[model samples]
Target chain A: MKSKTIKASATATLINELDKALSDGFKPTLAIIFSSIKQDWKAVCNMLDERNIKVFGATTAGEFIDGDIEEGSIVVMLLDMNTAYFKLEFLETSEKTTFEDAKKLGSIGKKTFSNPAFILATGGIFIDGEHVIDGITEGFGSEVTVFGGMAGDDLIAEKPIVFTNNKSKDNAIVALIIDKDKIDVRGIASCGWEAIGTTKTVTKSEGNIVYTIDDKPALDTLMKYLGVEVKLDETQEIVAFLNSWYYPLQLERENGDTVIRATRFANQKERSLICTGSVAQGSKIKFSLPPDFDAIETVVSECKSIKDNPEQQADALIMFSCVSRHLSFGALMQEEIEQVQNIWNAPMVGFFTYGEYGRSKIGNNEFHNNACCVVALKEKA
Target chain B: MNQNLQTILDFIQQSKHLSEDEKATLTKAAKDADKALTISEFKLVRTEKVKRTTAILLEETIEELEHKRKAIEDSNNALQKSLKELKATQSQLIQSEKMASLGELTAGIAHEIQNPLNFVNNFSEVSKELLEEMQEELEEGNLEDVKEIANDVIQNLEKILHHGQRADGIVKGMLMHSRSNSGEKESVDINNLVDEYLRLAYHGLRSKDKSFNAKLETNYDDSIKTVNVVPQDIGRVVLNLITNAFYAVNEKNLLQETQGDKYEPTVSVATNTMKNNIEISVKDNGNGIPQKALDKIFQPFFTTKPTGQGTGLGLSLSYDIVKAHNGELKVETKEGQGTKFIIKIPII
Candidate 1:
């Protein structure tokens, strides 16, 4: 197997670059695209289709190649793996149909490959990410392999689209199913944010909207603790943009691994907070402070430990990072990406996402927020 | 354990049917399998521990959520019996506004349905009495008086049928108002609804507290027959306002009795037809709301009443409901004299 990477800002550049890469008769059979929503994704899909490459594409908040991070650009990783060993599938989804659609995809993956490793990128605002993972696990009859990220539309939050060769949908899911026995798949999710306060009980919550924490209004409690003063008015739209992303709640799991849930928006009328993930009432949660630069070290080390290859080699690498990290770390986010990229010293393609999906440090396949998920693929020896 | 592998190796060594090359190959494969099995067992153990702990967390989370959900459903349904009984009124209020609207809805249904029913019963009895009078008049052979008596009986019977049909309309209208299309504005008899809920709120209070009693008054404009509005939404606001009036007066009655001062607890409701809009006002001769609290009365979860007694969502929702109709909700109050709440909706 062989892999090639390309980064382009225009369709003409993408086509020109593809012509140059194919000049050597590499003849790639699969193309994985991470592109900005501002780019013309349809044209890129058409060019790849002309080459007869199976396309697995998602719109990204930001994209990267190797050591450089680019915004509003296109990054492609072309693989020449046997198409017989993998299949690309796409489907539209809603709050009602997301689980069933994912379940069907899982069943299809099982039928296609005896040992399947599923990779996904979902698009939709109100989709419960955990349900996707759960449906796949149930349909496959057990956990085999699952990893992916939710799609993003830069910071607009309007529409994050996922596409195939000819069709595209904003509220949809795109998946890649690989024969894991043929292509050894390994990955890990790392969150280095540190908890700052004592655990508090969620007193009143329904779904992802929390009304209160520790017997006080959730918005007021967060404001007082964070020392923020915003007038409670009918039209106030305070949310993570006001530094809540830096201090998202750290959910303490009984498995001894803490996961994060970001409060994305607030309701001035109801005195509640809307979280990106659900926080069950009576669950113990604590505030988190953004990590120091050393957080990058934790991520890089975790990436290294997942290396099954004795030489720490990888044919292709992909990353799914939460967009909040980009917003909070600013330019420093590049440093973290560089360190993770250096671990395997291989061609890589990645994007900042709305949320991350991968196995935790405890090896539990779960959906995560404000996390960095890195996956490495290599064919068996 | 590795003991099984050691046992297998020992069996291979003792067998006589194997060549030296086969024995060497078998030994290496057995050792590799043993090593892989050990590592797999360790990973399996770790996975099982995490799964067990996660199961505990899931159980606790589900149990706690179920308990809270059930409690909220119960408190919300205490006064919403009539809503379910009139199941045809499937309002979208069942989602976020459900907790606030349920009790208020029953109060409206309870108060709105009672008026025409009382009239029906009274008219029925009157018709029966007039029937006996006609019989006597006919027996005396007074033809002129008999004819007058017969006309009176016919009038009584007509009144009975009118009241009976009115009762039926009230029931059907409520059912219609609760449907998913409850948001659409419909022509409704504002005076009839105001009058109905006023009595209904009083009876609801009386049934709860046998010792609680107050004077109820109505000053409805006869000319204002029907106003364009969503009947259920308007009914909720009116019922909340009237119910609060009764609560205030009852509180004052209790205080005045303890103070050894004579007091008359009166709650009066009036509907006025304005030039461009209609105004519904509820007044209570009890201790008025505080000046400081006037601004926050319409804010959700801000309550002047004691905890567990007031949800603090009633007035806030009432204010929103009125605004959704492009109307205004305002209050007039004196610290000790009284309070009046006025709601004005456009004529359209």
Candidate 2:
């Protein structure tokens, strides 16, 4: 397998870059595009569709090509493989039929491809990414590899759009199915945030909205613990969202791996918290502390482990990094990407997401917030 | 060649090809060069010794600095621990001061109310005696019209006596609660103590908030006789719980008025006699404790009340007092619903 990444500021430039890649005898079978919300996604979709190029991608808060991070730029990763086959599917979902749509997408991939590794990107707003993962897992079972992220809209609170070669939709999911028998796939999800405070039990919650924690209004309790002044206004809600970026809640799973969930919205009328991922009632959670420099070491070390392997050489790396990390680490985020790049020296492309989805050390494909998920693909010889 | 100066002289004499001045010059130059070489070697040895001495001094200084840093760190840790202990003691002292002031106030109120109570009791007794004489005269057929009036007078005196005795009991309880605990255990009736504090706490809050009212109910286990306890301390615990109950209900009542909700504030005190221990529960239908604050309610300087409204020491002190008596104090609460504080003391 061979991969090439291109960064473009316009539809014409993106197509030109694609042509340049093709001229070099790199005939890509599948293209993964990560574009900023400022770009016209419809134009990009039409251009790629006219070329009869299969595509799957979403809008990003920021895009990464190789070791460089860019905002308001489009990045495309073109993959060409001799033995592997690729399929793309897109589905639209409403509040009532999100789970059903996810199940349908999962079953379609299951029937169409044998030994498939699924990559998913879903709409970020007003949907529980956890439930989508659950639906897919139910159809594909636990043995299959599932990984992806929720789309982000550049942190402007805009609607995140997902697309296929056929159409661009707002509340939609685009999935890529790769036959794993033709390629060796390895993934790792890591969040270096530490649990700082005492454990609290989730007393009342429904779907993604948490009404009460420890029998107190979830919002009030969170604000009190954070020492934030109590204000029941829109400004207060904004403050809560900003604070949650640094201090998200960490839930410990039965396998000892923790899943971080960040508050996406705060409901003042209901005095509730709506997170990017779903949390069940009676789950114990703790406020996470900001990561230290060692967290960067963790990401670098994990990448090094894969790159240092003597048996296989990785062809490409796809990263789904949480936007909160960008906010927290600032320029240090570049150093993290560069560290990984220094090791693999491969074609790497990814985008910052609202929430990440990947299989953890616990061996479960779970939804996460304020984390980094990396997928390394190689062809078995 | 110095073996000989003699050999050198002979050699110089044998050098027929050289002049005497040339030989003398060569000999002097060789001697001077040897002397300069010796001095240079000596300087090199001294310079090497200086460098070695400086290195040794640097190594010592580094070791000394490391030792000093460790000492400073140890001292800083000690200071931090001492500061923490001091803060804890300071909080305890503040609580004690509040309790002392409360004791003084209760004593003053009890003393002032006791005099008025005595007159009411004494006057009722005299009135009852006069009514009896009149009843005897009517029975003797000397005062038929006054007989019905005498019975009415007797009934009125009995009612006054009953209420007056209740007031007297409250005053006595206040006096007991105000007195400093002598650190001596006494076999005190647990039911009476709980009932006394319930009334005292109710009246205490009523004196502050005139519109505040709560239905006080008591269910005492008649089977529970006297149990050994520090009466004053136990009484304080009961008073703290009941006072908190009344405050909760009053706060809830205020909210109810604004929301147009129908809520009857109620505070109930109940005692149960168990095989090994006795349990006293003070419950109220008030805005309950928030669950996040429940675990910390007994921590010093932790309070939900606004500044100047609470010392944040009541529950902490109460917990300590209960523990000192080898008893357990536990609470159950639901947000916006109610709270129940249960005090369980061993029968021993």
Candidate 3:
């Protein structure tokens, strides 16, 4: 099997990357991830239109796919898996999918696909990823594979976007069905950060704004843990210090140089910490600092093993990654992207996520805080 | 899934064409194909239609229940709001009544004081005139008229003291009524107390609103000697009624001013002695209470005054002051007619 890789720095650059991949006979099955910038959405959508590509993506706090974080880019990975049995249908209906709605929709989708199919969906407004899981569970009955993330808006993490093949919308949910006979998909989620330091409990918490932790103000707790004073006026510079090894607060990966586990949105006003996963009251939290050089090398080495596997030799691949890793590894994040490109030998596109969801290295549905999730889909044997 | 399966089977059956014998054989074959499927084809389809109809009915019932729940919640909120408004009105009415009674007592005291002062002014002028005339006669060689001059001086001095004492008596009466009249509760002889104040209050009113000609009547109870009361408070209540009677007559003068019709104003003071209590009333024939002002008359701070002349605290304070003594203060009045105030006190 032969593969192609597409790379772009910004959303405008995605069109050229796709054109190049398409020109190389890469019949692209598109997967995209994006952060919430009010601008560039329309431009990216138009570019996708000109390229005749169907988009499936969600608004995120930040996007990292295949290791690179696209601040304003729509990272599109185009794939061509020549399988006649696989059918792609874009379903767009106005009816809000309650449990009943999902059940109905699931039944319709199931009729078109065989047993052991994957139901990949993007959540609607105010819908949690759990609801999407629940809807798919009801519609297709208990015995179906379901996976997706609730959409996110930048660091605000408020309104989520559900991208259909046609356009981006706020109040819509989209599902992509993959039949078992058509594709064999394998998903793995991993991060390089290892839990270190003492634990901190979220003292005061609200939906996304966690104002304090450990009974102290959230910003104050972050400042104290990092040891160095950060000027809030220079947000990016202070955020750059998020992965500064001299004053690292995030938990580092014990096995690799993957993540620094950035404290994304901490609310000093409410005394709480809002990370990717569920942080309970009175739960202990520790910082994952930047990883060592050898750990970074180890992560690439492990991902290379996925390339060596006979089953993963797919015509295409899609990766979803956390954006905080880029700040932790700096230029090394680019190295991780290049490594995935060299090993997978396929068209790769993904966005940095606020949170990551994938099967663990041993295959269990897991919600990750700071990790990268790689899914390689190939023609079924 | 069930509906689709049924539709598919129906479609297959509708599409078939066969010879008469063949059709019969095929139909028989379809019936024996699967026992459960044969039963479902015959019985379950009809039952399923009924179930669908019932489900629609159930949906309607749920909607109706939700509507009723919302209506009940709205009514509860409305009822709570109205109850709060009612409580506020009751408290305001009670407070208003208290102040009105106090105003009436004050007006009575003012009228009582004014009467004696009018007499003092009238008599003092006469004394001044007599002393001047004596001085003139002495100046005209009346040195032998010393006895005459001394007699005149002593007579004038005695007249001054008489008028001075009358004014002092009226002031003392007011002070007694105004003092801690609510505190000193005692058994009072109702007939005696009413007769005394009626005489004093009437004479006092006649000195001021002189056009006030009310026929006074007394139906005093001789048997009921004493009742439980604060004497000073009881006296104040008597004074209030008498003063109100005189004012009612004065108001008639206003009607006379507009109509120019002669109407007689009469005040009747009566007391009935009972075995356990005594009832005293002061009735008047004049312009009575108007229908609109009736409800508000007993409310404090509510006045029909032109300002600077009256404080509307008479009847309300009287209601409380009377109620405090375990007695009733009642009124009977009609427009363009007359008014009567009846007070009943227990003989303990």
Candidate 4:
């Protein structure tokens, strides 16, 4: 397989770059696009559709290639692989039907390839990402290779979309199902945040809305307990979790592992915190301080775990990094992304997401928040 | 003698054994690695600051949670104490309701016993006179007069015995109502039970207010043999319903006094054997329960009477007592005409 990456702030400039790359007699079968909602993503799909290339696209908080990251721009990884080895499927769902929808798609992927690996991008504000994981596991009758991210609308936090040619929806999931026999797909989800303080119980919550923790208002308790100050916009609501990203809640799981939960929005009048995923009432949780530089090292090292040695190479890389990392690490996030890209030295395309779906180290596939998920793909034959 | 890599590079640069271009590339590579190391060092320093702040936060949060746990424990202790006090108060209120009903029955019971006692006294006085007459006749050798006097004394003795038993039954019934629940069920005659409460309730009211009078009527169901029930609890219920019926009629009677209407205050109590239960109903031809107060008629502490007249627990307690027997208590009322309370107890 051969791959090339192109990025531009405008759809026309992106098309020009595509034209320049195509003129060199490089024929591509698929285009993986990550872009800001401000860009005309519809035009990019049309251009790719004319070229008979399958498009699996999502709106992003920030889009990046190997060397640099940009806002309000488009990044594309054009791959010239055998069409028989891969299929792109797009599915839409209602508020209460995301699990069933993902299950149906999973079954379809199973039927498409004897041994299929799914690369997914989802779009929904309140969808429990774990349901999708569990549903797919049930539909396929077992767990398989699954890697994806929750779509973001450039920090607007309103309507993130996952689109294909001529179809896009805020409540939908787009999958890239590849036959693992023809292509090797391996990935890792890494979060190296250390938990601080004793665990506190969530006193009251429903779904993603946390009402209280330790019998006090959940929002106030989060601030007071952590001694962290969060800034509010003119409406007295935290804007896009920009200030509180550094102090995410680490959910203590029964298996002795922890998953991160980043507060995405707030209800000041209700005195509640709205999270990217559900925090069950009575579940124990601890506050996490910002990760050190080792966080990047861990991500790169774990990505290398899929390979036999450090010198092993990948044809292409796709990353689903939680947007909280961007807000927390600020400029330091670049070093992490660059390091992960260096491991494979491949043409890479990725976007910072609302949440991520992949497998953490030493676990089954999972839904994660405030973690970086890197997927490396290369043809086996 | 030194074959170290750094030493080799130094010797090459000093002896001019390597090209400047080669030396420049190696130097650039070394500088790039150093620059990467520098970036890592900077991130490490920043992370140390984060650790210090996080340490402080953890200490403060752990302290606060400990304090909250202590306060919650204290609050729980206080709540437990309050609960114990509340239980005591509830039982006291139940007893007070019982004593209040017993007080209402006291006057009626005394008057009822007085009637039987009067009969006994009259019969004894007559018997004494007859005995003196018999003695005078015997002194005159009149056998026929002595025999007639003896027969009269025997008849008086029988009447005295009948009245004495009637007084005893009233006292025993009064005692049953005032006693605490024995938690036992017994077969009791429904007609006799209703009759006893009807008379006791009426006479009690009359003793309290001489001007308050109401006509009483009864229909006893002869077919109702016996019902297995907690006798004291059921007696309390019957007494409460009859008393309420009397109060209703008297209330109407007082209103009628001003209107000068030809209203005859009547309270009718009856017992009947239904399909599988004995139904006792006390009906009053007086003002009924108001529409707004209908729902709350069986709620504790909800009184239709002015303060101190009723305990507001009569119907509520009656409802619970009937429920304990797996029975039903129902009320039917009209706005201005009347109200009828029905109690149905399963006949065993």
lDDT of candidate 4 over A46-122, digit per residue (tens): 99999999899999999899858788899999999899999988988866787798899889988999999999999
DockQ of each: 0.01, 0.01, 0.00, 0.21
Model 4: CA > 4 A from native: A228-240, B1-56, B68-348
What are the lDDT scores of the predictions, listed in order? 0.80, 0.78, 0.58, 0.86
Model 1's TM-score against the true structure: 0.51
Pitting candidate 2 against candidate 4, the one with the higher DockQ is 4
- Candidate 2's C-alpha runs over 4 A off are A82-84, A228-240, A306-311, B1-348
Q: Candidate 3 at B168: error in angstroms?
A: 99
Q: Assess candidate 3 and give its lDDT.
A: 0.58
Best by lDDT: 4
Off by over 4 Å in 3: A1-52, A58-75, A81-162, A170-175, A201-219, A228-263, A301-312, B1-348
**Highest DockQ against the true fold, candidate:** 4
Off by over 4 Å in 1: A228-242, B1-348
Candidate 4 per-residue C-alpha lDDT over B1-348 given as tens digits, one digit per residue, 9 for 90 to 100: 123545645654676666888887775665565556655665676677577667768787778879989999999999999999997886787788889999988998999999999999999999999999999999999999899999999999999999999899888877777777787999887788788777778888889998888888999989888889888788889889999988888889889889998899999999988898889999999999999999999999999899988889988988998999999999999988999999998876
TM-score attained by model 3? 0.40
Per-residue alpha-carbon lDDT of model 1 for A102-158, expressed as tens digits? 788889998999999988898866677777877788778667688889888887666
Q: Write the per-residue lDDT of candidate 2 for residues A30-114, one digit (tens) a residue.
A: 7789999999767877777776667888999999998799999999988876533767888988655777888887788789777
Docking quality level of the chain pair in candidate 2: incorrect
